[model samples]
Target: MNKQNKHLPNFTQAISQLIALPSISSSQASWDQSNQAVINLLSAWFETLGFTITIQAVPGVKGKYNMLAKLGSGHGGLLLAGHSDTVPFDENRWLSDPLQINHKDDKLFGLGTCDMKGFFAFILQACQQLDIALLKKPLYVLATADEETTMAGARFFADSDMIKPDVAVIGEPTNLVPVIMHKGHMSHKISIKGQAGHSSKPANGINAIEIMHQVISELFKLREKLNLSYQNEAFDVQTPTMNLGAIHGGDNANRICGHCELDIDMRSLPGMKDQELVSWLSKALQPIAEKYPARLTITELDPSSPSFQQTPESELVLTAEKFSGHSCCAVNYATEAPFIQQLGCQTIVMGPGSIDQAHQPNEYLADSEIIKTEQLLAQLIQHYCF
Candidate 1:
């Protein structure tokens, strides 16, 4: 049961190489350069392994690439998907260099080591060990860009005619458990406009901030109502939840504010549609909009497709469970699973590392987890590809 010998050394090397590049999604300059570098390295590696590779670009971001590498051919194959972007990090906050993989006490400390790069490393290592001649069906590795910020890469891939398999595995950190279901997150900006006037004569002018408060109050009541109405046993929270993440208004204390804005974060269940929730909010805000000379606008930010729910009996779930030797469960976090699921393919979120380590300052993945992930991936290829 020596874990190091069970997984190939190339997986560790891949993790080290990936960690060397600071591909933080929010850092436009770093992301632009690092994304292409990572893709180029991966393309060369995959091509050497005798897999066909393709690189697709995001519309606005130059040098940001999405890579697809395919081995073997036919239906009912497995698609391994992962994002190449990491969240922004401050250099001063870390104990070690964030871009350099630091090994201590069987843990790998580095940015992007856990959030996603580890899974990509595992996939690369697994593919290198497989013989293309023995594969019965195609195996595709899809590495995407901007998953942390906008999910633009996943959205683009979902709409394309690229190699869609019968099943997909989203390599988000899941502690190696198969997440068959998860909630979808919807972010929106609510803006209200009204007439500005002197504070003494508040009645003479419409107070946008006051109107916004009223609307927000009504929205909170609606949120409570929805929370009470819908129920799902699979999810930890039985009902959808809404939070006003941020709010801004009033340029000066002396003058009545003419505009106000609030950012809303809504988590929708598997069965609930985002449009339904938007419609309900619109209806509730209508009265406030009519009472004052106010304008209400809702701008969606990173509107997710929906939450994915794979059947417990699905082959993909069964395969993942067998590989991990553990029972699967549902999670509340959103992922790229739903968009991949739209291709008539069952998708699951399964990978090493805990979700808690994803967006923190000193984000790192346990070296033992990486070793375990590498072995599990190798087993998957041996079982499904051979």
Candidate 2:
């Protein structure tokens, strides 16, 4: 079971190599980088382990890629999946290089160490212990791109239906707990255009900020409606919520405000349709748009991440709970599970590291999690693929 004996990199080495490759996914152009390097590294390692490597260029995305490494072949098996990209990190906030794996305080400190290029490293180590020839069913390791931003990689791969497994496990830093449910996310931008004029002649120009005030008022009412309409006791936030994340308006105190923009984020509970929510949002703002004529516009910021929920009694959930010794729970964060589940596989989010550490400066995974997660992955492979 020793990786060194098989001539493959050990756990620390694997994670270190992954950490060294900066595959950051951000909506901002300056922060985003290609995930092809990480994908290539994973393909090389898994290829060494006798898995067939399929490196797919995520359609329409210039530099993103998804790696699907499969061992053996069959209709049903285990799929260990996670995203290849990490969120943007701030170097000044970290005590050590965020791109290098620093082993300190019994933890592996680095960007993406736990959320979750480290998950791929764990998979590689676990596969090193297994005999691929004995696998009765296929074993798939999926590395996707843009999970931190639009989740376009997962959406493309899942929609293609290239492969299907009986179960899918997304390693999304859930602290090794079986996460059966989580909310979805969608962002919207509302822009208002108004004529500019001298501040003394307020009537000569349409005030975009003043119009935005009415829009905000209506948005509050919509939030109240959502709170009253949806409730899930399983989540800490029992109802769907919306936040006005950003607002920008005109610059000068001497001039009338000519334009304004508002960015909003909505998190929906399971069973709430994304389009339906958009429809409700449009309905709420229709009056303002009508009153303002061509001055108001509402647009979706990016692809929506639909909420995900797996049944409590499902086999995958039960198996995960049994193996991890924790009951299935819910999280507020959105992951790629919903799209993967679209392929008709039983899916759950259970992985090493705490979500609390993800995306934070000096993010890390406890060294103890290495063995524990490797063991758990090995057990799942034995049960599902052997």
Candidate 3:
């Protein structure tokens, strides 16, 4: 197929345009911005390159889209996947416009420049050098939505009819290292309901605040059990962990505390399941609920992202480690790789720039890192497709 029938943005223009377009994906409604513009920009570029472009609308998320651009067709191929959206930025804290590409100290600073709309630009640049005719298997450029928030785009794509490649790479800033395993994220709110009464009449009503202490104690116990049961030395944090994020209860000191709510955050290891943990929690709190005649309920804040692990021996992981010259390791953060892995493709998270730059004020991808990424991706393409 003929490539670049029409003009396309060079690397600089591509990065600038992607950054200028606001595609902030946040759980807060006010901070959230549609990723449609980013997808459309990518779609047009892929179309110019003679790629078969298909924009899949994420089912319940209005104005959100997943762009899948195919360069060739076959049973197996290489997939360069990344999220189009970035985390909400603190504009006041930034030295320059967060939505504009600013260069300083040999770095390109902007939202999504590192964590990772810029990834697609490098991928596209690499593809420009690779002839489509030389590809025996498909080379797909995929951009998904809401990775900073819910990962809805990745979750939807996991079940979609898109081609399942034999190997996949998620461009989530890992400083050019190959990450084969990462922790999963899950959060919940536990609400305890009880009747209110005067402080003097302690027997008249159940004190939710008092009982919540017991609940918290039980949670601490559960956390210890979880920590002891699951441990992977590969991760910086060697065990599955839980945190008591927030809590709220009754009104004043004079009134007996009637209602209490606790929000929790749990990071699961590869072998652990959030559903099973929640079930255990309910069972553990059952006695307390019965003893105090308090109604205890547990509800999820958002869908859990299951932990992902690609064995070091897997071809994808080995190839990534070889190309990047970094040993396969684990990251502390969660990513879209787990969802992509569910499709049966051996996935590795390897991309340009350091993760410390992500979600921080004045985020950036260094010039050296960008060039290194382009060269590395070109080599990967040659090895996998040529």
Candidate 4:
């Protein structure tokens, strides 16, 4: 190890400390927790290694935080980014404490072990192996909050227009592979309101459920249209998809259905915009709304992330492919890659651990991956920072 690395925490030590801090970000209020502690701990660790630390609270998000640690100074540097928060875990489903790292059979089990706190350990280990005095360009480590739910930290960072690196690597679990393209995510709630009255006289009140049927039909038409219109063979699905996840309406059979609500989720392709899709959907239902008037409403569930596609020929993608010895591929899942790419940098998601294990009970990262990831990160740092 380089002399500079001697002062940093050991690989497992860092991972242990990170996992012990439960920074679960969830849409449910009971499960959501602040990520400030995680950010503070990372800030301290990075500061000890001669990095300049800047901690910023994600605007509009009450307690979340984002940390930027810069090691060297110059243009066209490399940004190693990861989210500090994990999905809420079910304690009863885990074999042990989800917040504590449990080592058995050469695997470390914890909430964020594979799904990503371990990636930060890899970053620290890689930085430790580097001799900072020889750095030719800057090296940045970003820790953001709320990746599991809203990606609020990444959105705030991208909008701030700070830290413009030449290339960015988002360490989302991919088993050491480079993900060059991924889908976008958007969800909406469609609500229909109508008068409630006895079922004896059907004309006494409007049947919201009947109106909902029309809305559902229009949605199906829109979904089919989207599937026929857009196609990206690189992804597994190869086409956009809309899922009608849930629907609720009348409470009793005795009365006309007073109100109805339908929840839907859509996965869009690379070139598709979230608002455009929403607009298309709204327009598709315009006829029903026109016929019913003042009863149909479409509401966005949350902020949507756009699909991301980094050119396979980008220098970062080529370098990662060459170093990791794996061809660049596409994932069907959405990530913070699009937000980071907004900084005018070539960005790709590459990291340690399998995404399959993420958010699962008893999540673990094989001990073997520890050294392999560290070595790969070292090679990347050498090529980009030095």
Candidate 5:
């Protein structure tokens, strides 16, 4: 770590404080919590580095904020971005308290270690000894809210039309590799309504479970069509994919089913819109919905992360690939990179740790990744900020 970086204490102290804070964001009220304290902590650290910090309260959100810290001055520059909130954890499932950092097995275990409050610690380490005065372009650290649930923070930032940096890197746990492309994610639940009646009487009432079978059939057909139509060799799946995750309905086996709910999620390829998937599913279920005269309604469970794809030849992608010492590839997970790219910035998804470790029981970050990320971030800053 650079000796001049006084704004943040040692990495252990910073990561410990971040993990100690509980900022879980979820659609369910029971699991959802405020991120205000986390942002404030980050603000306090950045201000020590002479950064101009802007804490914007996310409108309509109860306790959320987006922190934008700028050092130096210029029209366009590098934006180091990461989300502040983490997903809810199961208490019984963890070996140690998720709120406290655990050092075991030569790894640091805690929530948000790699997905990714830890990335901000890397940013802090990178900013040390930086002659801010010599920087030709401004350097920005954007800590956003609610990436785990709705991406409300990133969406709100894009809607606000704030600073448009020339390049951005979202540290989203990519095993230290640069990811130039990824699929979009959308999840929806469809509720089918019907009247309950005796199973012995066929005409007395409609069977919602039976109706859903037709819905599933049409969905499979649609899925087949989508698979054939969209293909990207960059991704392992190559084609758009959908999963019928869950279904719930009825009470007794002897009684006619009154209602049923189907939940599904899909990942779309670049140049493809999630709205199209929603529309296609609705149309596929239209015939069954009309035949049974049943009522069906759909609700969005996810905030929708659009596909991220930066041109391979772009300066930012090339530079990140070179610095990381890995070729750019596509990831299966969606990220806030699309939202950051929406601000007229070329974005790359790169960070320490593996995606497999994220959201798992007792998630951990390898100790080696810490040192590697610090050095890589310093190089990226010097190449882009100076």
Candidate 6:
């Protein structure tokens, strides 16, 4: 709606191009088969825009590629980072085809249109309009894989000797606002093993299910303790919390269960160390270990995505706030910003879609939000790179 962005062409074609490719990262088989299709398309688009592109393959996932493209020749430029992967969607739950971009009124609906693919489209559009002759620093665009599942691509980028920018922007649907801080989620599965016997005789069997209940009770108490310990005024909840996401054990009613497993989710504040949280959980479960010879095994499904907090006065924060015509705020959902910040670059999460639309059926990005994102990105390019 801004006057500055009026001349730019509609981004619907680009969004359609992206939504046609199903890049669901959670399904390994589907991701492996279709990831290259999206990568090849993006690589060609970037190459046409005069960017030198490289497709980096992550280990363990064949055909999944992380594409890095750079424009201009100088260093310390801005990096527009987004994930090419999306969360898996059930086809039966959608009223319309999830893979096709459908426009209804002012919103464009599709599978990845809101969760991320729309943001990638805007980045591509911005790249096509950039003038290398007027740029002061090189611009880097990184499209990573597997952000919905393990964030393996970001972890790989963190360890590699790739392009290190002075500041990084994670294009994760923030509704055009800058998100500086959020909670980190750490998931662990605890497995317990015990003796199995006939249910008729109570003393003869060590019930794994009963032992798991004891462990879960202790975890609940630990959650309350955490609620009392870490509190922040900036966040709405003001404290870290824990949840028992899942519990599984026992075959049938006839026998004592030999194995039981519990899945625990811990959300931490910005200052809490992940290892420290694990250590605290270990200590809490220590008392029950000797009761039933219960074996305690903890395996983290996804490593803690640490919380993000940057000083309000930082250049990146200030620049983003000014360009977007909004103030900085904290979000409850985590982004790839914290991981990117570990690379010694200031990071901010900002983009077109709203968090309300993410991970929901018939998810969409508003046309107005897309236009606003384009204008803000144009201002950012002029101020930082030009």
* Highest-TM-score candidate: 2
How well is each residue in 208-270 modelled by candidate 2, as lDDT tens digits?
A: 999999999999999999999899999999899999999999989988899999999999999
Q: What are the models' TM-scores?
A: 0.93, 0.98, 0.95, 0.97, 0.97, 0.94
lDDT values for all models: 0.82, 0.93, 0.88, 0.91, 0.88, 0.81
> What is the number of backbone collisions in each predicted candidate, taken in the order shown?
0, 0, 0, 0, 0, 0
RMSD of each: 3.1, 1.0, 1.9, 1.4, 1.4, 3.0
How much is the lDDT of residue 274 in candidate 4?
A: 82
Clashing pairs in 6: none
lDDT of 6 by residue, 1-386 (tens): 12213333347877898899988876455444447778887788778777899988987666677888888877788888888878878778887899999899888999889789888788766765666678788888888888887777787777786777888889898888888888887889998987788999978988889988899899989989998888988888888878888889989898998899998888888889888899999889888876545376778877577777887789999999988888988887777777788778888998888888888899898878877887888787767778
Model 3 agreement with the true structure over 1-386: per-residue lDDT tens digits = 33433487778888999999999887789888899999999999888787899899998777899999988877778889999999887789999999999999999999889999889989878877777767888888889998888899999999885687888899989999999999899889999897899999999988888889999999989888888888999998999888899999999999988999999988888878878877878888888878866378888998888888888999887788888888988987899998888778889999998899999999999999977899899888777776
> What 10-residue stretch in candidate 6 is worst by lDDT?
1-10
Q: What is the lDDT of residue 95 in candidate 1?
A: 88
Candidate 5 lDDT, tens digit per residue, 46-161? 89888899998887667989999999887888999999999999989999999899999989999999889999887876787587778998899999998887888899998888
**Residue 248 lDDT in candidate 3:** 99
Candidate topping lDDT: 2
Model 4: worst 10 consecutive residues (lDDT sum): 1-10
Distance (Å) between predicted and true CA of 131, model 2? 1.9
Residue pairs clashing in model 4 are none
Q: What are the runs in model 1 whose C-alpha is more than 4 Å off?
A: 1-9, 27-34
Residue 21 lDDT, candidate 4, scale 0-100 = 96
